[model samples]
Target: MLKITDLHVQLEEEDKKILKGVNLTVETGKVHAIMGPNGSGKSTLSYVLSGREGYEVTQGSAELDGEEILEMDPEERAAAGLFLAFQYPVEIPGVGNMTFLRTAVNAQRKARGQEEMSATDFLKEVRAKAKSLKIDADMLKRPVNVGFSGGEKKRNEILQMAMLEPRMCILDETDSGLDVDAMKLVADGVNALRDEGRSFLVITHYQRLLDHIKPDVVHIMADGRIIKTGGPELALEVENNGYADLLEGTA
Candidate 1:
C-alpha cells in the first residue's frame, strides 16, 4: 500500500543527508520488518514518510496507494491512512488518555467527512480495545503517558493504533522497553489489527519482536539505505550475526 522510490532526505538547517536512495514497497496484507543498527536512518525514513518538519526531501518520492505523499502535511498523511507509532511517546500532562484518544479519533473522522462518535459510543468501543490491549481503565483515566512506565507507553501507542485503524502503520521501535509480557500484549494487539487491506512496517533492532509478529519480508538498512531484503530468516541471521556483515561495504 506504500511505495518509496530513490528517496533522499537531509536536514534542512544542516546539509547532512540521512536517507540515500532508499527504495521500498509495502503491499497490503503484509508486514515488513526493517532492522538496522544505530544511525542507520531507520527513524529518519519514518519521519520523512510522516512529513515531519526539518527533514528536507532532496530527492525521490513516496506514494500511498498511488497518491504522492511527499508534499502532504503530517495531518494530511494521517487522514490519508498513514499512522506512525513513535519510538518515544511524548507525555501530555494536562490531557487525559481517553480524552486525547477521543479527540484524535473524532478529528480523523471529521477529516474524512464522517459523523463524530458520541461520548458513550466512543467510550464503549475504546474500552473494549483497551481491554484487548491489556490497558486498564484506570490507566486511560490518567494523563496521556505522563507518569506511565515504558511498557505502559508502548501499550498506549498500540491502543491508539487499534483505535485509529489506519491502512498502513509504521511502528518505530515499539518494543524498545518492554518486558516479555508487555511485548506479547503489544504483539497481540498488532496481530489483531492485521487483515487483507492493512499493512505494517515494523522498525526494530532485535529479532524477539519479529518472532511474535512474523514479518512477511525483512530488510536490512544501514548508513541511510536498505542494502538487503529477505524473508523472516533474515531477522534471525541479523540477530545471530549482528549488522557487521551488512554494514561493512554499505557504510
Candidate 2:
C-alpha cells in the first residue's frame, strides 16, 4: 500500500540528514512494524511520509498505492488515504472533540467527491466509535485533548483513525505513554480495523505494543536506515537485548 525508495530527508534549516537512503514497502493487508532506538530517524520517517514542514526530501520517492505522494500537500495525503497518529497529540482548546472529528471526516469525504455525511449519521458513528474506545459523552463534548490524560489522547488518535478508515495507517509511537490497560484498548481498536485492503506501518520503540498488535513483518532501523528485516522474532530480539548489538554490527 505504501512504498518508499531511497528516501533521503534532512532538516531544511540544519541540512542534517535524518533518513539516509531509506527503502521500505508496506504491502496491502499486512502490518509492518519498525523498531529502532532513539535518534534512529523513526519518527522523522513518519513525519516525512505525512508531508509535515521543516524537512526537505533531498532525494528518493514515496508512493501510496501507485501514485507518488511526496509532491502532495498534507491534506492531499490525507485524502489519498495516508494517516499519521502523532506521538504527542496537540491540544485544541476551543474546538470540541466531536466537532473536530466530524469536520475532518466530512472534509475527507468532500475531497473524495462523496456527499457530506449528515449530522444524524455522523452522530451515530461518533457515538458508536466513541463507545468502542471507551470515550464518554462528556469527553466528546470537551475541547480536543484539552484536559485529557495521555492515554485518553492516544485513544482519541485511534478513534480518529477508526472514523476515517484510512487505507494506509502510520502510527508513530502510539504506545509511547500508555499503561497496560490503555495500550490494550488502543491495540484492540487497531486490530478490529485490520482488513485485507488496509495496511499499517507501526513505528515504535518497544515490543510491548507488538505483543498486542502482532505485525506481519518486523524491521530494525538504525542510523537513518533499515538494516535488518525479519519476522516477529526480530521484535523479541530487540526486546531481549535492545538496539546495542543491532547498532554495533553484531546482530
Candidate 3:
C-alpha cells in the first residue's frame, strides 16, 4: 500500500542529511518493523512521509497506493490514509478528546467527499472503540493527552488510529516510556486493527514490542540507510548481539 524509493532528506536549515536513499515497500496487510540505533533516521522517515515541516526531500518519492504524497500537505496526507503516531504525543489543553476525534474524523470524511458522521453515530462508534482500547468515559471528556499517564497517552494514539482507520500507519517509538502491561495493551489495540486492507510501519529500538506485534519483515537501519533486511529472527539477533555486530561493514 506504501512505496518509498530513493528518499533523500536533509534539514531545511542545515546541510545535515537524515535519510539517504531509503527504499521500502509495505504491501497491504503486512507489518514492517524498522530497527536501528540512535540517529538512524527511522523517525525522520516517518515524519517525512507524513509531510512534517523543516525537512526537505532532496530526492526520491514516497507514494501511497500509487499516488505521490511528498507534494501533498500534512492534512492531505491524512485524507490519503496516512497516519503517524508521534513518539511523544502532544497535549492540547482546551480541546476535549472526543471533540478532537469527532472533528478529525468528520474533516477527513469531508476531504474524501463523504458525508459527515452524525453526532449519535459518532458517539456510539467512539464509545465502542474507546472501550476496546480501555479508554474510560472520563478520559474522553478530558483534553487530549493532558494529565494522561504514559500508557494512557499511547492508548489514546491507538484510539485515534482506530477512529481514523488509516490504510498506512507509521508508529514512531510508540513503545517508548510504556510499561510491560501498557505495551501489551497498546499492542492489542494495534493488532485489533490489523486486516487485509491495512499496513503498519513500526519504528522501534527494541525487539520486545515485536514480541507482541510480530512484524512480517524486519529491517536494520544505520547511517541514514537500511543496512539489512530479514525476518522476525533479525530482531532477536539484534536483541542478543546488539548493533555492534550488525554495524560491521556498514561503515
Candidate 4:
C-alpha cells in the first residue's frame, strides 16, 4: 500500500540530508516496525512521507497505492489517506476532542466528494470508536490533548487513527512517553485496527512497543539509511543489546 524508492531527504534551510535512499514497502495488512537510535532519520522518513515542511525530497518518490504523494500538500495527503501519529501530539486548547474529530472526519469526506456525516451518526460512531480506545465521553468533551496524561495523549492519537481509518498509518514514537500499562493500551488499540486492507509503519527506538504490536518485519536504521531488515527477532536483538551491537555489526 506504501512504497518508497531511493528516497533522499534534506533540510531545506541547512542542506543537511536526513533520509538517504530510504526504500521501503508496507504491503496491505502488514505491520512494519522501524527501530533506530536518535538522529538516524527514522522520524524523518515518517515526516517526509506525510508531506511535512522544512524537508525537501531531493531524490526518489513516495507512493501510496502507486500514486505519487511527495508533491501533494499535507491536507491533500490526508485526503489521500495518509495519517501521521505525531511523536508529540500538539494540544489545541480551543477545540474539543469530539468536535475536532467530527470536523476532521467531515472535512476528509468532503474532500473526497462524499456527504458529511450527520450529527447522530457521527456521535454514535465517535463514541463507539472512543470506547474501543478506552476514551470516555468526558474526555471527548475536553479540549484536545490540553490536559491529558501522556497515555491519554497517545490513546487519543489512536482514536484519531481509528476514526480516520487511513489506509497506511505512520506512527512516530507513539510509545515514547507511555508507561507499561499505557503502552499496552495504545498497542491494543492499534492491534484492534489491524485488518486485511490496512498497513502500519511503526517507528520506535525501543522494542517494548513491538512486543505488543508484533510487527511482521523489523528494520534497523542508522546513518540516515535502513542498515538491516529482519523479522520480529530484530526487535528482540535491539532490546537485548542496544543499538551498539547493531551499529558495530553494520560497520
What TM-score would you give candidate 2 relative to the actual structure? 0.99
Per residue, candidate 1 scores C-alpha lDDT tens digits across 1-251 of 99999999999999899999999999999999999999999999999999889999999999999999999989889999999999999999999999999999999999999999999999999999999988999999999999999999999999999899999999999999889998998999999999999999999989999989999999999989899999999999988988897677565
Angstrom error of the Cα, residue 48, model 3: value is 0.3
Could you tell which candidate, 2 or 3, scores higher by lDDT? 3
- Backbone clash pairs for candidate 2 read none
How displaced is residue 244 in candidate 3, in Å? 0.9
TM-score of each: 0.98, 0.99, 0.99, 0.98
Please provide, for model 2 over 1-251, each residue's C-alpha lDDT reduced to its tens digit, 9 standing for 90 to 100. 89999999999999699999999999999999999989999999999999999999999999999999999999999999999999999999999999999999999999999999999999999899989999999989999999899999999999999999999999999999999999999999999989999999999999999999999999999989999999999999999998898888844
Stretches of candidate 2 above 4 Å error?
none
Candidate 3 lDDT by residue in tens digits, 1-251: 99999999999999999999999999999999999999999999999999989999999999999999999999999999999999999999999999999999999999999999999999999999999999999999999999999999999999999999999999999999999999999999999999989999999999999999999999999989999999999999999999999999576
lDDT score, candidate 2: 0.95
**What does each candidate score in C-alpha RMSD?**
1.0, 0.9, 0.6, 0.8
Error of 2 at 13 (Å): 0.8
> How many clashes show up per model?
0, 0, 0, 0
lDDT of each residue in 22-127, candidate 4, tens digit only: 8898899999999999999999899999988999889999999999999999988999998999999999998999999999999999999999999999999889
What is candidate 2's CA lDDT for residue 52?
95
Candidate 4 lDDT trough over 10 residues, lowest sum: 15-24
